[model samples]
Target: MAEMTLHTELPADMTDTRGLPGVQPEHGPWLRVDEAYAAQIARRIALLDDVPEQVLYLETASQGAAQELLHEALNIMPTLGFTVEGAQVTCPDGRKVDVSSTAPLEALGRCLQNDFVMMEKRGDEHVLTGAVLCFPASWSLAEKAGRPLSDIHIPVDEYTENVARRVQRLFDGVQVGRPLWRFNQLWYQDAELHQPRSATAPLRVGSNLPDGPFYRSERQTLLRLPLSRAVIFVVHTYVLARADVPELR
Candidate 1:
């Protein structure tokens, strides 16, 4: 694993001063690091602070052309919908305010999907490169699938046991990301699903899949869910080494 470090600095005048409503659960903090967007920001800051870490998963062979890797990372970012927001700090007695908004979380997810990394040219070959690791939670996928806040189906009684069991099994061997909405629609549209004699039925999106990364293996994670009527799905990311990509020459 190769490590790539990144640092970004901006002028003070460009800062943002907006604050998102804190996560207030029924009893405690409902969400960690605010929504996906906030979490991404916090993570970025942590990564850049102090001794600063580097993207270590990138193989040296992939680190040949800097522009190539950056371009690729930029292209993949939109797939996850990530943006950066500006932040501003207030005086000693006054409350610190925020004043920027960009969907960095979504972008980070997509970048991670493409395995965003920076490669450097060394001698005649490139090797393990550096990359920013991004793995999104289950809620990010649901939101991507167009599930609304009103869509989450919660019963008066908690089904933690049932939900956890079903999730563990159904999403086994999968990395949690975005639900395959298109695939899910097609699954529900299957002839058997509408047939009276069919034993299997499709489920709604929010009713089943909980928010979190569902891993299928050590190296692979689910990038999308199945297209069936089930709200839950497991999508895995399969990294293709340089050897996997077709030769340009």
Candidate 2:
């Protein structure tokens, strides 16, 4: 899986668990950087250029929200080591990306280390309207693109019917300013950044043992856009050698 790209160490104070607030209050800056920033961003850019169809999807109706997301990202990224001037943004890796594009989601995929997913409440449940997901853990964007929260997570045993209702409620209640975040830890045999497996296939994960060669964790943050009122799900993925995380041993 394309020469393992990983952070030398996981973030300090990192922990595991599952669920909606599985969750906590996220402070100021939504965009973040880590040791693997350059490599991960490079991987994202390559994925966008090579396989745009696999990584990016924007519904026709979600255009306005998508543009709004780009705007929001442009505003926030500057504070986190990104330089934004005019219509261009210089990422931490010294790569310049156009902040403005006909495809704003793709533009975002070019600039940020985190994979951004935009979900808007359609009727009874929120729909996965648009996303630039380069580093999916083991789920396909194609399979989960237009599906509702429950359907998107159908393969996950923890996402029960009752939990689904609670999560929907949490989504409905999450305010525009205050954002909540969470992290899930998993073990893996290898440290491939872009691991997208289709829903129909049987899963292959390395969590059966106490630990494995690598540890992968995704810090997922939930933000409500002030303009579109759509929820922005940000995933900052981290992978490290199993030996780097002392808590696991």
Candidate 2 stretches greater than 4 Å from native: 1-4, 16-21, 209-211
Model 1 collision count = 48
Supply every candidate's count of residue pairs whose N, Cα or C atoms clash at under 3 angstroms.
48, 0
Whole-model lDDT per candidate: 0.25, 0.83
Q: What residue pairs are clashing in model 2? A: none
Candidate 1, residue 163: how far the Cα is off, in Å: 35
Candidate 2 is scored at a TM of 0.93
In the range 1-249, model 1's lDDT, one tens digit per residue, is 110111122222112222211111122111111122333344434443421323223333333333343333344333344332223323122323332232222233222322232222233222113334332211222122222211222221243545434433433333323321111101111111011111122333221433212111111112211221112211212111222222211
Query: Best candidate, lDDT-wise?
Result: 2
Worst 10 residues of 1 by lDDT: 182-191
Q: Which regions in candidate 1 have their CA more than 4 angstroms from the true location?
A: 1-35, 53-64, 76-126, 133-249
Candidate 2, residues 1-249: lDDT per residue as tens digits?
A: 334467777655465444443877887466888777778878988899899999999999999999998998888888888899989888888888776654899888888888999989989999999999999998999999998987988878778888889889989988988998878887887888888998888777745644568788888889999989999899999888776765642
